[model samples]
Target: MTKSRPNILLIYTGGTIGMVKDFETGALKAFDFKNLLDRIPELKHLDCDIETFSFAEPIDSSNMNPKYWVEIAEIIESNYNLFDGFVVLHGSDTMSYTASALSFMLEHLAKPVVFTGSQLPIGDLRTDAKENLITSIHVASLQHFNEPVIKEVTLYFEYKLYRANRTTKINAEHFEAFASLNYPDLVTSGVHLKVNTDYLFKPNTKKRFKVNKNFDTNIALVKLYPGISEALLRAVFSTFGLKGVILESYGAGNCTTETWFLNILKEAILNGIQIINVTQCSGGSVLMGQYQSSELLLKLGIISGKDMTTEAAVCKLMYLLGQNVSSKVFKTIYETSLRGELT
Candidate 1:
């Protein structure tokens, strides 16, 4: 609401984008992102006012877990009112996971939280970090009628902005490192940045942002394979004291109709372990009951994941479990889309 400038927070959680070259050794090293203004001189030309905070000991995305997610959430929570928007510099490997976690952790958010990273070090001339970082900030600080646009968590890569949880890393060598097959790009870069206004979610600005930091990480993913046995199914289902399970079912959410396999899943559900049915395919949805192979799952009261990506489903389930909501409500809420991350 300030006329001077929108204060944007750049949270550097360590990634290729935050790396620089050690001239003597010519080795890539993580630099203090608090000196972001010194390295990215072009940032001064932007209209928005910016500030940064970096992890004390920068961690690669591979080491990311619930503990780190709590740190990021706490940072945002502590500074929620001070900044108009946020841009997270994170490793591409777990960016989707963190983004998905945040979408649920940060409830009723009315400001953009954009996550972007690069494949090459920022100090490299061939780096894509500059464009990704700059554009992500612009997208975060963007406003119309003095109201912030993109009031949700998103991942901007190449020239497309995707709902973070709905996306997955598709290629290693390509500049387009991520893709949201189940969802459309919220914005596309071109002669003029084209915003998908109709698809973009508009949060109720009156609602206060709430951070849900407590997450139960006791979750497991099981992928169905051909010739899989009852013993394997039973073992996978037996995650003692686990909070949730993401079952990566075959095409169209199809799983084996074998009695043992079905019984194992049925027992897990009965034991109060939340299980979500997601498809193994990258693009298609888990259309439960669409084929006979998956009919048993529907009959067993297993929750259909619909078109949710695995990343989204996992994070969502963790968030829901953390709240300790009743089983009935968890089922209802998990199937519902709060941040446009799922269908």
Candidate 2:
């Protein structure tokens, strides 16, 4: 049952948004969330009951990995019944990867899991942290007819809410740091919060909510370039325990039709290694057979990562590989959009 006032859980996984100035040392330090109201009194105005949880030690998003991703999944699983929604404070760097992993790991989501962070510390005079933090909680708290307005993993940044698996951190120096190229924003924040209901993911709430923690980190991401060589390909393919590869192919999923290159990929597949073809371009779908260069990939049965961000492809590969499914099942599911990740 939904509450009269949403009980929002704010999970701090560490980032600029959680930093504050140390008066004695003048160094940036993680702000204690126990004094959240004192730090950001703006939160008090939202019509919700807010609770806070912090990682035992802050992990920079650059240091985020599959184990930490599982830790996050466990936290949500343990608290799923108590909270209406969750807001994750993460470092902007690699935030999209973490978000995408969570989307796939958390099956049958029925509440909003809004991931957000800021470019500057919350204590800075001109910080963007306050707006990001307050609005994320408000977004998580939103309800209509006693049901959650958002029922998917999402990244709320700058002023837009995007499907987590579709997002990419596009800029480093700007306040607006993320973009969802192939997909549209689920919600926009301006004078008032505006939701694009048609774009929101409709989950199968009847299914039980659960978490998948066994992520395989034995995959590799290979970005193709104009002068990439056979030796380089051979070395990467030879890595021990390597189960899958996210091949960042050329525009429209094209790659050299050269026999040597194709042979290496062919050998990998024959040796029981899976390869997925994802576009290097940030804004297009990987239509495998659209061109002569990409046709071989179709014949080779390489998985097509249609319109999926590299971050999503990487995380999806990890999640699926961890499942220990047969190659046939893995390819079928990897090509399908389980979390609205690909168009």
Clashes of each: 0, 0
- Show where candidate 2 strays beyond 4 Å: 1-3, 23-25
- The lDDT for every candidate, in the order shown, is 0.87, 0.93
Model 2: per-residue Cα lDDT over 1-343, one tens digit each = 6457989999999999999977788899889999999888889999999999999998999999988898888889999999999999999999999999999999999999999999999998888899999999999999999889999999999899999999999999899999999999999999999999999999999999989988888989999998999999999999999999999999999999899999999999999999999999979999998998899999998999989999999999988889888886888888888989988
Error of 1 at 3 (Å): 0.7
Q: Evaluated with TM-score, which candidate comes out highest?
A: 2
lDDT of 1 by residue, 1-343 (tens): 4586888999999888889888789988887777788989999888899999999998999999989999998998899889999999999988989998888888888889999999888889888999899899988988897778888989999988998889988888888999999888999987777899887877777888788888887889888898988887677667577768899998889987888888888888889888899998998888878888788788887888888888888888888888888987888888888878777
Candidate 1 residue pairs in clash (backbone atoms < 3 Å): none
Q: Which lDDT value does model 2 have at 228?
A: 96
Per-residue lDDT of 152 in model 2: 95
lDDT of model number 2: 0.93
TM-score of 1: 0.96
